[model samples]
Target: MTHAPTPAAMATRKPARTAPAWDRHTWEEALLAATLPHHGARLLGWGLAHLAPTSGQFRAGTSRDAGYLGQALRLSAKQLHMGFSQLERAGLLARAGAAATDGPRHVLAQAFTLTLPSATAAARTESDG
Candidate 1:
């Protein structure tokens, strides 16, 4: 006989996430909407989508350490570390200031800004001017 589900199990279960449907957008818009080629690009995209502020040049958030984020992203901490580095190298992600120091092991979250590729190019051009 099957037993009823336990409270612990019920509490640990997560609902399936639904993918967003696109409207009447252009092919280029759809292409740009896909995750970038960089390793951590998807993570940055996730931040931009979930953290609000999709318009404009930059999206900012305080990201928790890799282990915690990995759990939510279905990635390993090592993978998260690599992704973070890749995004930083591609100029897509960066520390907003310093790491937050108000949580466990003095490691809670990292303040970061995710920059759009067009904005990055514009910044480079302006600096060269």
Candidate 2:
């Protein structure tokens, strides 16, 4: 005879997987809409799409601490800083502490919100015009 699943067994079962909250298409649209430079837009898009989202914010480490991001984006530390500045100006990103340092051990700390409604609106206006 088969035995019924115990409560402990049921509790241990993993939850069903669901689709990701954001997708490639959403990233592309946000990137296209942002008023940043090409590199800045690219960096922002990549960061939002690939980086883990913590409380709806995406954070970046110093260039030296680029980890997967630098290698994947093929951008130097200097380039990353420049992109960060551009995004900040456009109100897409916000940085904390000192700016990114060239030192290998130091990491530039930055964060940004996931939404890009302003950028999207600007893009729509440009397209409509």
TM-score of each: 0.41, 0.49
For candidate 1, what is the TM-score?
A: 0.41
Name the runs in model 2 displaced over 4 angstroms.
1-28, 59-64, 96-107, 110-112, 115-129
Q: In candidate 2, where is summed lDDT lowest over 10 consecutive residues?
A: 103-112
| RMSD (Å) per prediction | 15.8, 8.9
lDDT of 1 by residue, 1-129 (tens): 999999999999998898444222332242244444453446534643454333312323334544555666676655565565444444455555654334322222455555434556435533532
Q: lDDT of each structure?
A: 0.47, 0.55
Tens-place lDDT digits, model 2, residues 1-129: 999999999999999998446445665575566655555445645665565453445555524345455566776656666666555455444455555555422334554444444655555434533
**Alpha-carbon shift of residue 11 in model 1 (angstroms):** 60
